[model samples]
Structures are given as C-alpha cells and as structure tokens.
Target: MPQDCERTPVVRDNGRHQWEKDRARAPRTVRATTGATERDTGLHPPDLVFHAEYRELPAPCPLAEAFGVPAGTLLLERSYRTRYGPESAPFALVTSYLVRGMIAANPDLLDATNEPWPGGTQSQLHTVGIELDRVEERLTARAPTPAEARDLDLPSGAPVIQLRKTSYDIDDRVVNIADVTLPADRTELLFTTRLERW
Candidate 1:
C-alpha cells in the first residue's frame, strides 16, 4: 500500500482536470538525473522492497496436517516479559499465545488448554489456548496420546510460556499495539492468529 501522502489535483489548460498519481506510489520507482557528462549517470536507484515480519517469530513455516497448522505459519514461539533478576529487561507482549503443532501431535497427549492463562496478576502473560476444528480431547483436557506430552518434557502439558517480549525495534512492517486484543477479548484472536499454523 501507498503509505505516503495523498495525491494532488491537477488543472489543465483544456478546462477539465483530474488527480495525478504520485510517483511514490508507483510499485517500481525510477529517477531521472542530469550530470555534467552524458556518461556521468551511473547505477540506477536500488529498489526498496518492503515486506511484513512478525516479532521475534521465525517466518511462519507450515507444519503437517496432523497438527492442523497451515503452511507458512510460524510455529516456534518464544516471548519473554522480563529477565528473572532485572526490571530493565523488556516486558513481553507474546506471553500466552496458542501452543505449537509439535505439542498437538503426540500420541500420548493429555487434555490441554493452549493459553488458559491463570486469571489474575499481570506478573506473567497467560495466553489462552482454544481448540481448532473441534480437535478431540478428553474430559481431563489431555490429548488422547499420552506420549505427546513426554518428549520435550515441558511440565508435560504445562510449559512455562516462553513469550516474545518488548520491542523497541520498528521496521517497515510494524503493527500498532492498539491492534492487539486482550485475553478476555479472544474471540477476535481466533481469526487472526490461531486457526492458521506456522
């Protein structure tokens, strides 16, 4: 999209006028410059390619169908709110996001909640997890497979969330914090974050 200023109106001698498109919005940019010698003009301007990137998450890469994750969806999730001893460490915004597909595939999986973050105190980010496509689960909320919870060994189903945290860095692809939804307002998060997998 054209992030630059709006276009200006043009008035022609013929009487009728129309808005002229700004060069900035042109997908392919070009410049014409003059030099002392005909050969003085050198390399053309380098194209500025802009694309979006999520914070600290690996580019979303697709997993398998068994995991119910879509291709190009980032799976390795890690967010941190603070260093154990210091307040200066950046606070994390990515704390209780949904669990990765690897966690969902194990045969020994038990009843699990992705981000059922503990209710009170902002001390930790408690991202809640919601099941996708009516994924099967037991009354205890464990995946039918018990071994799925064994390998990585992160408290079995309850892994102390490794969240993506505070970022002072804003590159071309930046998201406004106003756009992020709170845990209580998760119905919106489903369409944007969880349904598709990395």
Candidate 2:
C-alpha cells in the first residue's frame, strides 16, 4: 500500500450503486458474486478472484449491543476476501453477521453452499419475509493490527477505516450487520448528501 494510492468507494448508503453497476456487466463468474465490483469500480480487474467461508462466532460486543441481544448470542458469520487476481492482494476484508435465530426460518440462509446468492443478503432475507427499510453505517479509524495488516496487505504504520453497517427491517429490528476493513492507504471514504434548499 502506498500513501498516494487511488481511492475506492466500496459502500454507498444511497444504494450499493457502485456494486450494482459493476455486477450488471462483469465477466467471468467466480466463487463470489462481486467479481464485477473489481472491474466496475476500477479497483481490480474483470477476472477477480474471491473466496468465502462461514463461521459461527460469538457476536461481537457491539453487535450484541446493537441488536439488543444477550451477550453470548451466537451469530452466523460469512467472511469474504476478493483480489484483482490470484496473485494480488485482497481489495478488502468483509465479514457479515446475522442472528442465527432470526434467519433460522430459512435454512438456505445458513448454508455456506448457497452463498453468493444471486442477489445477495437483502434478497436472501426476502425469502423469509424480512424487508430492509433502512441502512446505517458508523465509521471509525485505527492503526491496523498485525493480523489485519497481513490480511489486507497493508504497509507498516498504515491505518485502516472500519465501517459497521447495520441493516434494519420495516419493523425497526436489525436484520444484518456487516463489518468492513478498508486499508487507508488504498481506500477512500466518501459520503454524498443531497439537501434541498431551505
């Protein structure tokens, strides 16, 4: 990672606009569905390589607090890492969590084999009658831990931007939470607000 690297906007509260545009025209179908994201965002390549895994980890303290669930709540977690190519460093590290009990109604949602579901989580939750009415993202910055640096290929002394995105349903209950790790050297965070004239 260099100090003057190009910035990539991986998340947009307005609508996953960057992802949608990329997925609409990406080539080479790979393990995960965001293959087009690399090319479309000009971050990676048309033939991006990616992998995903599922882990049942204890919910992070913040996650437990956000969902109003007990401290020991078990969370269904999906981890994904994508690279421009087999030999390239990952674009970012993403891990998403959902309350096991909340999604237990749809067994398919728990199975790793069913991942990269055609339309992603919002669509998958729809199968179980959950409708996302809003998304909120809280961001923070910190120096990368030794482990994070290795995973994201960060240079020494480089910091990282952490994003905690919470998805809420029509009933106002949180349905999904995602933690994204972006290397500061090669990433940029942008927020666009459209305000009407007073």
Candidate 3:
C-alpha cells in the first residue's frame, strides 16, 4: 500500500529508448524520480509488458463535444494495458481517443499493427502533420468499479486515481484525449511549474 511507483511526463527530448523497440529484451534498469522530489528509485522498462487494441467507433456526445466534432463522428479508440510482468495486474488502464478525420491522412494511424509506436501518440500525430502545443492532465480519486478493482488487483477499500489527459495542437484544437486509471496504493502524481523571474 506504500506509494512506491513514480510517474512523470514523457517529454519529446528523451528520444525513444531502445526498450521501446524490443519488448523481449532482458531487463534494463532505469531510475525514476519520486513525486515532486529528486529522490530516485530503480525501475525496469523491459520487465513491463503491454498489449494494445484499436477500434473505430462513433464518438459519444460528450466525447464529440470534447473534440468539437459532430455527434456520432467516427473516432479511433486505442486501449492499452501495461503490467510489471506477464502475470501481474496492469499498472494502469489507458484509453485514448482521436478524431478519425484528423488523422485519416495517415492510414497507418488507423491500424493497430503499427503500434508499440516508436514515439507514442505525439509521434503518431506528427505523421499526420499535427504538432502538439500542450498537454493537460486532471486527476481525481475514487473507489474503483468491480471490474477496475479486479483488473488492477486492488485491495479492499483501496481507491483509484482517474486522470484525464487532454492534448492540444499548435492551433489550440483538442487533438487527443486519454483516460488513465492508476491504482492509488502504488502510484504517485507529481506536478512542477517554472515561473519566469519578474
């Protein structure tokens, strides 16, 4: 139940690591900074395993509104589960949505076969000429649903953190939206802001 895991923003600068290319590679340890602090802990990307599933579906009214699209507009939904090991529960449940028309120019984006994408969502959007301007994450905690509790292997009374991440393009349009569910028992959220000297 200790908050032992750390999560941080993946900036464009950390060029795709080699582990992203070979999932079966031997475990390679990396350091992860603790929440809002400089303390580091060992983490292994190679030890984590994941699967992705993609589908095209009509955008629900709320989703359409978020994307500023017409109700029922086709959207690409990508779901992913990445666990510490083959037999472990997922670290987080992630679902991402993108407006189909916006990325249809790149047919590859519509296919799941091309996933485990080198640079992840930002890079995928780049293939269609979309440059990200900013990413906003809103976090909230609540009791997990029966399915979520089971999927995340939560102990009784343990809550889950629901994070809604909204990505905006350089033009200020919402380009992608993702909902991530993390087990509160092991997760830590960090936020840092730098202000220019007045």
Name the top lDDT candidate. 2
What is the total number of backbone clashes in candidate 2? 0
Model 1 spans with C-alpha error above 4 angstroms:
1-66, 74-78, 86-198
Candidate 2 off by > 4 Å: 1-14, 17-46, 58-61, 196-198
Model 2 C-alpha lDDT per residue in residues 21-97, reported as the tens digit of each score: 33433342632444335433555444566677997878768889988898779899999777655334676788999
Query: Which whole-number lDDT from 0 to 100 does residue 93 have in model 3?
Result: 90
* Clashing pairs in model 2, backbone N/Cα/C closer than 3 A: none
lDDT of 1: 0.21
Model 3 spans > 4 angstroms off: 1-45
Candidate scoring better on lDDT of 2 and 3: 2
Model 3, total clashes: 0
User: TM-scores of all models?
Assistant: 0.17, 0.77, 0.78
Candidate with best TM-score: 3
| Candidate 2 or 1, higher TM-score | 2
Query: How accurate locally, in lDDT, is each candidate?
Result: 0.21, 0.71, 0.70
75, model 1: CA deviation in Å?
Answer: 6.1
